[model samples]
Target: MACRQPPLNSKRPRTLLCHDMKGGYLEDRFIQGTNTEDCYIFYHWASIDIFNYFSHHMVTIPPVCWTNAAHKHGVAVLGTFITEWESGKDICESFLSSEDSFRAVADKMVQIAEFYRFDGWLINIENLLCPDAVKNTPIFLRYLTDKMHSSVPGSLVIWYDSVLEDGKLKWQNELNNQNRVFFNACDGMFTNYNWKEEHLQRMVAIAEDRLVDVYVGVDVFARSEVVGGKFETNLSLQMIRKYGFSAALFAPGWVFECLPTNEFHQNQNKFWNLLCDYLPTHSVSMLPFTTSFCQGFGKRLFFRGKEVHAGNWFNLNAQEMQPLFVDQKLAGAGGSWVRTRGCSEDAWNGGCCLLIEGALVSEKPNVSVRLLSLLAQASPRLFISFIYKQDCSDRVRLALEVTTTNSCSCENSQITTPQDHRKGTIPHLLPETDNLVSQFKKQCDTQPVEGWTINCYLLELQESFLENVFVNISRLPDADAKYKEKEEPFAFRVGEIRILDVNSLFAAPVQVQNLTMCNTLWRRGFNDCKKRENQLYLSTTLRWFYPPNTAVNFRIFCKGMEHHQSVTIAESEKMVLIGRAYNRVYRVVDIPIPDPPVGTSGQVEFLVQPITKEGFVGQSSNCSRLVVNYLEKQ
Candidate 1:
């Protein structure tokens, strides 16, 4: 997915994130489901939102995953260009041999920046250079900086505090004359993390006009130098701010990579909060939407904002509103299992859904999601959409069980209300019971072979509903005698579980129409649909009733046959721009259509979700399907 360059922020004390995890990107999974805005609340005041993908390579482009995740949080991401160790010295020698050679390399680097859509690069030259090479290095840096600025506006080229003007690999750890020459050529410099208080003061003095450009480095994992790394991290942050310098935090992945698995989220919070204590509190806006589930699009397992490369996990539930719940104890303990196979396309806006199937035990397993108070106060309507499929010809029943406590007001106790509420026991409160507010059932069809149908249940909440409510999708007891003895469990898959505020006047509805599909191939740099069986693409036209400058997004969901069962192939696109356009716009999306499962007719289903620019997902359009029986002969 190509993206436009992020806007520049002139905020002071900018925080640069140097992401280095296990030799850089090895077994690295960027699953940012948690609200990072809340995690780094201190960063709101200080511009703490630049992510740099750090690796010891000649040309390291930031991965699409990192770019997508960072952009979602309104953060800028940068790739790395480093020349380190013996091989790097050779690379620098060949590139800086002549002025023309240097200029040619700089142009190529500029081309890479335009192609990848990252903001800029962090140039780290950590190897010794010859006198001739060192003299031309500044020229090369100047050329690269000028070309990059011209090609990609608002782009940055940060220099690491390594290598001196005398052609030697030295860590100055301060903004002195030895490194001042190189620093002057780039946008900023990242100082070595092993600097002292005097060094920071000296650097601040040296960078009098551009204090924000000099970023003091802090290594959160290196305990040998920084005693009590977590607390010391706060001290470094304080000292950098006191000296009027930006901060560069290196290797923050230590919170996940080194800490205990269960305590990863807690330790991460504590570590960040220590930094927060030094800085003034700032209120970051809560995310407009949040959801919790154990399953994802690919085979990789992501739970509680952490990704495990290898696992066919089932029944692992993460915590609500917090990012620390990787419960391995319940792995495969199984009352509810996620069925990646035969899963229908997600009916809602997200990439994947909870494909659950199992018999209800004496204590029914339930997953509770915490909703924001904004949602409750808005008195929004909740919609639970899922696909139900079963072997028996019996009706499948499920319900939304809401657990809320009611607060009663006294007749003439306005003065006593505060004390009663604080005691957690209102004298006039009524006893509350769990209410089965909404129920949904799918009746047996005429042909009872295994099949699925989409169902939706809506429940509108009032202000009386408590802050935290648990909506459980549980199986109701069967009354039929004949089917009661059957051991086979009924299966149902949840697609879109959303809470929407329909009361807002600005919340206009969007409609998707005129869906079409065709087979296409990339020939001569353009899509040609003349040839069949090359690739499948779908196009749809959308209409919305919103004013100009309103941002709208369309997400396409596709389901195809895999191993004789329907499984989701394409969930959603990464950050497609449908915003700022007038009333109607047509979008063409690639549909991932695999060969039909054995003994099954080739078919695919497409669904579209229209969402607001603020991340509020709307209802799913009715499925627009295509049958590919023509490919069977081929």
Candidate 2:
């Protein structure tokens, strides 16, 4: 069950995001559950390297949705293995009874991580252990670490700084001899949040070469003597960086939990933006890269430039590789504002798209945003494609920012007016003083959805490798003095971005094998569900498999038809996207089968469509389907 995928091993100071919610498991726990209600989602994957799903449960496995999203950005996902309170103390006694029991427990933990396909575990032992159990605690930690490393290479087992060597449950707040034994046993240690400046200095002294391995914990909720958290969480992050240590941000979802739902997205971005200078950005190395700029959760669902489902939904599995946007602050200069965020109002590919809306000022007429940190070797036949649209008439020139090995200077480069490049133009290269290069392309295809236009340009790269790519938007410099007087408003949206080697495009993965449905349950009617009065609620598990990473994910849809008395009309035959599956297994809970007349039968055909990393859909012939028959019982 070990995930053969390589684990995260960042040389820079790492950032571990520990998600601690009020109630651990929610709609996300069902894996493919269709959630209409409001849910919390983390989209700043580039800001952090490790994500730990934590709860009070003894085995808090990260839901597959989180794992899928995290893994897409090369971020490692970890589940919490915690013991707390009175009952936890008893659980520890049983596990730490003897050497064999401890090893067995460690093996089980490793198996869980392997089966779940997550990176590793966050060992948070918050309960007291007896004298004998304490003696065996380090033994358990060592065995778990060894097994995890061997079974899942590059996997991690981070210990929490809680228990003292004397068996007492004491929060040392930093690395010391009191809890150094456990730190030595594990890959890294997440220190408690109450640590002071002196504690951090001492921690650095003790950590020595392994300073990055010791995660200085910061409670975003501002518990204990933690310097600053919540809106000011960056204060603590800056301090942590000054001392040269990794950070463990506990409950970074404070924006979702504390702020209003309407403000969640803005506040979340603001919170992370504060730490931009402190945390290192993760680079994209994998090929066939694509992103719709989807935040994964949205008010409506759109697929392939069309609206598919019109209901509020949250699914981290569907989240694309988010663009690393740095907020541009004008500092109260006229009506000028330059910002970028995910918009649910419209999308060309998925549920959301990247929206850049703002007015231009004399000081900052053009906004150049860094889209991605890429480490890629460009081939001769490489293609870069993206869809964009301008909402306003203020003509703006668009350019792509790229970094090459050759030094090219943009010091004397002037901003140009928007041009009609319907037949493609040679990219404008900088002179020989800078590494940054700006390239522009011609419009290729116009999407049916709104005014979105697609641009696919073949890169005739003179250099071999690229370090980054950015999105640049600029306006023409007018000679009239009134040009600066009028703050030009521009609203542009990028629907999707795709980078691939044209000649070596990967073949679509084979169809899912062993397609089957089991544990089917049908419900007739419930009084509380007046909205779905005649809907037959069918709960089932649709299991299918393609290899791991065969395709990014499988989009589950149903072509259902309910039979009537006189004629078998195609009532429910409209293709409906029921849910999405990151893994092979998807639970079909409450797939509303329209109520048929008594004694009449109905059939539902579930389709599994694989979507690749480069936004390529598998052939219809290669799709797997499951047929389910339901009869109305008197």
Candidate 3:
């Protein structure tokens, strides 16, 4: 349902900390361009993988690169965690189930947090309770709280559900006795999207009078048809507090969660303007949109006739084709046709379209279907436009990210920016953002508090973009490549991406190593532990861009080899590389590099080739170790 927006340029900022765009991954701080003001809720997910990736960039990286810039602008950086839904059903699913696991994961997360100077974790309480997980959740939270506080005291922990319950509405963890105890363990709590106004008011009053702080939570999309109004709404911070809400979490739609890109403007930028009025460094998401690929008029038959190829770093989840093409396009112009290996048809194809004349076939010949599974989250919009080429201009296709459900459009907005000079109202010139931020800073210096974001949910995605291993889509024999069994460029392409949730940091430390490659089947990075064997496998279908053929030699990393019988790619002597885990605790491993392929572009695979017991004993935690270089006839 459509909701009313406050005046674009109001005399004062509104109530609430208008959450910046964080469908989840954050964009650059300076990428912002708006006038509204509100505190920002910077959403960042943490895991062993990302911790290692960003940690190395921390020292040279300025505070602005981390959370300091947001803080300077009165913004709060909340590091939300992505976890396994099974854990909420039982503590066994905890990330820190074992002492060894807990130590490794916790230490890494804390150290990374410390290195980046992050404020706190925007804890995903739901994932912990996705299944029958309510019982063990409290234990897990308390355990997590203790783990975090042990290293950094007063770390603000934001609960997805309400936590404050002081009498007189003070923040006193006065909810359910059990929940209150667990909630009290946190400095603040955010209500779920299911919360009503009365409950919200009570929670707000308590935050103001009883508790040190209060936060409200909102889902990226209608996780399950929100009980009330439109989901991604943002009111000003002052207005929110005065309206009886301590803070607001103006999260964007699902689009922001998968791949932050330009399509998320409606949900992301709208809130940024509304909140930047208060928060110094607001976080906005630019989730990748399928529209990025498509270019046609209207929604029907887009990408009708155009040869399309994915970029080397193409993220399927955020990809689309425009100018709908007919069946001919799927049949590659050069004898290529639609082919499905394993999985549903929708899951295999991206989208289909075709355009032709009475007796002419100048349109897209064959249109490949979209991979419609979980990857197709964005409802892409098509815009058919033309470009000027040499002699005559062809239809230079493009797509736009506009998913408003035909309702809830910000265009022709009822609210307008005030043109006349007017005096500031209660919210126009909010000093509370700075006040709140300042107060938060002082508290951190003295004693850290658990974090909070009112009525908002945060999921800490590990590789927000799946980076798993995928071997044998195309052939890789040393540095030579062949396509369609013909002399072609060798390429390593990625297909469906399978991801693992590691939000249970304090509960279970994960040993993510072991990469095996042979024949058509390459299995690497397997969790060797007995208990984990079942729950630790994540692999995607190989796109097989590289054709297997040719007689050539290649090495992944020659500088660090233990023996002369070097490692190789799956199946052939033509390709060889090494995969090792230097420090198992750091979840760091290196991928072997082979000689560059001759005349071919390849895709990056998230799969790893584990070192056989006899090969090597040391592994590097750095991803740089995984090499992907092939020369063309060099």
User: For each predicted model, how many residue pairs clash, with residues at least 3 apart or on different chains?
Assistant: 0, 4, 164
- State TM-scores per candidate: 0.55, 0.85, 0.31
On TM-score, the stronger of 1 and 2 is 2
> Which RMSD values do the candidates have, in order?
14.2, 6.3, 23.3
lDDT digits (tens) for residues 1-634 of candidate 1: 1121112345445678788876664432332222121121111211245789888767888765456445433456788989988888998888888999999988888898788777788889889988888898888888888888898877788889999999899987788989888888878898887888889767766887899888778888875565235535787888878877878889877777777745654565466656653432111122233333212232333221223223221111111111111111123324532121213133122223444444433233333221112112324454333333333334434433332234421111111111232222111111122121121111111121234444344445455432222223334555666644543354544433333333322344445555554443212222354455454343333333333333333444444523224333334422222111212333333433445555544555544554443334444432223333423343
Q: What local lDDT score does residue 352 receive in model 2, on the 0 to 100 scale?
A: 86
User: Model 2: clashing residue pairs?
Assistant: 408-434, 409-431, 409-433, 409-434
In lDDT terms, how accurate is model 2?
Answer: 0.74
Model 2 TM-score (2 dp): 0.85
Q: How many clashing pairs in candidate 2? A: 4
Q: Please give, for residues 1-634, the per-residue lDDT of candidate 3 as tens digits.
A: 0001212112221122223343322332321111212212222111000111111111222223334323322233446544423443243345435555544554666676566665455444333332223444455566666766776543545554532222111222223343454455555555555444555556544444433345444444445634322332433243344444334343443345543443443344344334333331111111221111211111121111221222111111112222111122122234333221111011111222121111111222212122111121112211111111111112211111111122221121111112211221111111333443333223212222122111101123222221111011111232322222332221111111111121211122112234323223223343444333322221222111111211011112323211122233332222223211211211212332222233553222333322211111112341223333222243
Candidate that scores best on TM-score:
2
Q: Rank by TM-score, highest first.
A: 2, 1, 3
lDDT of 2 at 319: 83
Tens-digit lDDT track for model 2 on 135-254? 898889999999999987778999999989888999999999898999998899999999888888888789988888999999999976788998888889888999889999999889
Considering summed lDDT, which 10 consecutive residues are worst modelled in model 3? 45-54
Query: How far off is residue 97 in model 2, in Å?
Result: 3.5
Number of clashes in model 3?
A: 164
